[model samples]
Target: MGYESYQQLGVDVADGVATLTLRSGQKFNAVTWQMHHELGLIFDDLTRDPDVRVIVLTGAGDAFCAGADLNWLRNQLQDPPTPREAREAGRAIVLGILDCPKPVIARVNGDAIGLGASLALLSDIVIAVDTCKFADPHVRIGLVAGDGGALIWPLLIGYARAKEYLLTGNAVPAADAVRMGLVNHAVPAGELDATVQRYARQLADGATMAIQFTKTSTNIPLRQAVESVLEASLAYESMTLRSQDAQEGVASFLERRKPNFVGR
Candidate 1:
């Protein structure tokens, strides 16, 4: 109801297209704890907004979403959320996206790392700039890829490839992502905006009931996956959050050095 009150997300609706943008451009639209909670709530509001026939998720600047805010990660080391809190928050975001009836298009303008990568893969259609990359680097930070990465990656790219990327945290180029079936298209930087706009308009103008119904049907497996897998994943991630390796990982990232994980 109060879209204007959102501090980290920029909400703009025009001609049935609601574009929800991650507004922290200076930090490559990296997500903060506040932004993460908002992401789980905004989709439901957009879905309820009668004028919003299609939803477009994008970043304000060049980067789509870099990942979680390192400051937030550091804070987690000191004041970790309980497992229940972690599980619920993670479920809210993933379930929110899967539950939304409107077609969601991800406008990946730049690199999508960790949670960023999961967000992109969750969308119904993902279009990225050719220069951008996608990766779930939670493992690199000594954490599990629990926040939708493990589930969605395998769904989009299959088990072997998903395992490889998730395990290695390698950044997959946009072209390779498209070829691997991780995203729908990869266009030149100049074409990204226009391309996404075109798709949005098409979906906005298409058969509403049919499209919404189709999206709901398409997400059945995703919803089931959320039910079956998300709880355990988030729980494990929470466990890792309390580990010395996770602390070292955040410290190394902040120090701009390779993490020396002792696997504690």
Candidate 2:
């Protein structure tokens, strides 16, 4: 599988490890439509590549991912995708990660926000820097935590904890994230790379079939969870994207002001 076709993601494979970097550092590696579309496709390609035994997902510059490109999202208000299109797009990315047989490690070098947090939480192993924070501020922007948040968060922490953070749009510090079981390890900034590489190398050089099959076995329940809830969440998200409060949320965020959300 040739990854040269992708525009927003940088793909490099060497010594049984494939590193996929979100390349839009200028925007804090936010998820542009192109990035989102490519992400939904790249995992499948990596899954089939013969030399790729493990995958490391990270960002180019500072933040792991700041979530959706708000400007692009704002534009989508006038030209929103149909509910079916939205559902399928969201499903592709979610299932792509869940169904991939390879072990995926999230090297969260910086803050993981919104969809960014979802990406890290979905990985097989998540390692972050102690200075970084994890947040899924979907509701802050008047959006449903539909992408993978509603499915994964409660399973990682608990229903009460998930709701407290998701509803309030609060940021979870790295130390708390580790304590809450949101991530595997939170090391100092200098240790982030080494920790991720060590884990990736171990998984890469170990018995590949056992690691892959174990991941597959564990993901069975996740796939079942996806089937039960992901679509409804996505559909609700699609509807919310067209809501009056969402418009205010985006506008306020871009303008750097408080949003006066009028429930609609």
Candidate 3:
């Protein structure tokens, strides 16, 4: 399939391992709604590819992904959103990653924020560099932690710790994230790429059916827990797309000024 958008994310299968690289240079790999939709399609394709045994997700530049595109956010605010569209888009993206049969690993090359953090947490294993940081600043932007944050963080780090991080929108350093059970391992910056490659190759060389089945089985409970919350949150988040606060949030971000959200 051909993609017109500037962002380039694709599958490269070799030796039973498929590497998916998010190629949006230096702007921290910010994602657009089209990119999210493309990701869903890519995941669907991967599900049918029997040759692929392991999947690795990483970014091209120094940072992994900073999150949603500011321009996309602005357009979303301007157009608002229908309930059906919201639910479909939100569920498709989250479930695509959650339901992938093969083990998925996140190679956190650098900072991962908002939806980026969600991607990292959803993976079967996450390898982060010492300089890498993770955060969900949804609340800071006057929005609920509506994406996978609400659904996955609690499961990964328990209710209390998840609440602390989500509520505060604080940045969690690599070492601190590992200690809090948010990431699988933390390695040196120079070793991050090799570390991820080693793990992905190992899984690729292992029993295909066994690995895929094990991943699916382990993720069943998580998928169940997220189903309802994801449905509800997507509706609420869509409703906000029409609100003045969301508009102000986007404008403030682009203008580099504090938002004057009046809770419209």
Candidate 1: C-alpha lDDT: 0.91
lDDT of 1 at 31: 88
| Alpha-carbon lDDT of model 2 | 0.92
Write one digit per residue (lDDT tens) for candidate 2, span 1-264. Answer: 688899989999999999999986457899999998998999999999999999999999877899999988999777888998998899999999999999999999889998889889999999999999999998987889999899999999999999999899899999999999989999998888899999999999999999999999999999999987788889999999999989999999999999999987
Residues 1-264 of candidate 1: C-alpha lDDT, one tens digit per residue: 459878899999999999999986448888898899899799889988999999899998777999999998899889999998998899988888889999999999889998998888999999999999999999988999999998899988899999999999998999999999999999999998899999999999999999999999989988888877787889999999999999999899889999999989
List the lowest-lDDT window of 10 residues for candidate 3.
Answer: 1-10
Ranking by TM-score: 2, 1, 3
Q: Clashing pairs in model 1? A: none
Global lDDT of each candidate: 0.91, 0.92, 0.83
- Over 1-264, each residue of candidate 3 has an lDDT whose tens digit, in order, gives 223342568567888777888765438988877677777677777777877788898887687889888887788777866889777877877888889888899999989898889988898999999888999987666677777888888988999999999888899999999998999999998888889999998998888889889999999998897778788877777777778787788788889998898988
In order of appearance, the predictions have TM-scores of 0.98, 0.98, 0.94
Candidate 1 C-alpha error for residue 213, in Å: 0.5
Model 2 CA lDDT for position 259: 93
